[model samples]
Target: MQALRKYGDPEYWNKRYSTASGTFDWYFEYHPFIAQILDGFNSKEISILDVGCGNSKFSEILVSKGYKKITCIDYSKAFFEHLFQEFHERLPSVHYMYMDARMLSFPEASFDVVFDKGLLDSALTGELSYVNAKQIIKSCLRVLKPFGKYIIISHSDMETRKEHFLDPSFDCELRCESIVVTDNDCHEGEERLPDLTFYAYIFSKHLH
Candidate 1:
């Protein structure tokens, strides 16, 4: 629990992301297929909320591809202040705000899509990890427009994250897919080369 406390602190994240050398995307970088998923939502008119937006360059990619309304929110104000200063010229369209994901302040049905990359992982480390994660998901659901997709990329398998969606408490539909990566760097017949895979969960908010 104490571990969760330390991680949930805004100051901790601010410090962790303050150094340039320390900045790196968690787990995998934005995959090309994910980019294709974004491209499918063409019309260039969708609003995206990147929850727990740390130092990842995902938003920059979205902006480069002409995504007009991209908002990145984190609890750490200092981290975003630094990011804003760093990418001001390139991210005029990106809105960086500091807010806790468990208690989002947005009005209902405010976003077309809400994305979470490893936010649940971080929340899972806390004392009330499951509870916190539920709050975060429900909060995200509240802000998503009817039929909006909440895409979460995580290293956690179905055994871990599947329960939150299965509780019957959330009014949403869920689908999860595993991402397989074939490391060509390894020999073709290498015994150790099993699929390098992870899971991406997508929850669709039901229209009331």
Candidate 2:
């Protein structure tokens, strides 16, 4: 599992991003759909938390559409510092914090939506794959508003992802939608990179 473990290592990502060239987005094409899903909330001014916010333009797109309260966090020193500087000049309103998904610092029920692209997938690569992923999900659940949506996009299948997110203890209802990837540029970092499609697993926190 050493290969899997590498994906969770901050140092591994630091070195990789250091050598990466132009904008290499794993979920480059998911922007429109992500925005579309968020729009389902029926409000542009909702407080949104983006976990493992890589160099993806998800938050920027939302800002363009008038999403004012966007907060993004990442543990990678490389990604955090680079995006923090870049967003400061551009998206001054979007909060970019250097934080780990497993231990979110935000107060309970602080955000209307908690969006994740591949944080859980990456965390599942560590030695404590299940524990890491569970912790991340728990933290996301804690910070979500009642009936808030936790949208996660990943290449993992139902069997792999459901067990982590489908627990009754999570106190959320789950619905999944299939996304057919048309782009030829599949992200090599993904475990299920061979497939031409991925999944968006959405967990809606209970309305209690």
Candidate 3:
């Protein structure tokens, strides 16, 4: 586990994406589950911010699904270059920027949706994980417009990893949903690999 702890480091991600070939979403990309996960909100016109977006084609897929005004941020310059090159002309609606999730440069109430797929989990792997994660969360809340949504897809359970989001100061309605990802090898009702469970923590800000 010590070796994997480096995931929290920006340099680690820089190195990782430097040689990366194709897209990589931390867990699952936008597919059978992404549409279902996003169906609850049901608005393609709203502005979306995808934090720590890495090389994931999730944002691209969202564009294909008819959602415009998507901004993706990552601390890794490598990812910014790759993502920009891959979609700049193809999908001009999606913007890629090099920025840290913990200190978003955008003004407050800038977006309608703030989404993170596996950034918090990566931060949780390093030292002062809680501090970093909370900083990111606070920024997410601050930059969201009233009644905006903060969606986090993580492997962490609610009992431990997500209880911190309930501090009242966050001012959001918290809900947890579980998604079961079965192995692809399961053929015609046969189970092969153990089920992998991922949690989606949705935070909808209160209008003041």
Please give the RMSD of candidate 2 to the true structure: 4.6
**TM-score for each prediction?**
0.85, 0.86, 0.89
At residue 53, what lDDT does model 1 achieve?
85
lDDT of 3 by residue, 1-103 (tens): 6986999888898888878866776777754655765665678888889999887888878898888889998889877665467657777878888888999
Relative to the unseen true structure, what is the Cα RMSD of model 1?
3.5
Q: Is candidate 2 or candidate 3 better by lDDT?
A: 3
Instruction: Tell me each candidate's RMSD, in Å, in order.
Output: 3.5, 4.6, 2.4
Best by TM-score: 3
Q: Taking the tens digit of each residue's C-alpha lDDT, what string does model 2 give over 14-65?
A: 8775555333456554555676778788998899998988776777777888
TM-score of 3: 0.89
For model 1, the run of ten residues with the poorest summed lDDT = 20-29
RMSD (Cα, Å) of model 3: 2.4
Lowest summed lDDT across 10 adjacent residues in model 2 is found at: 20-29
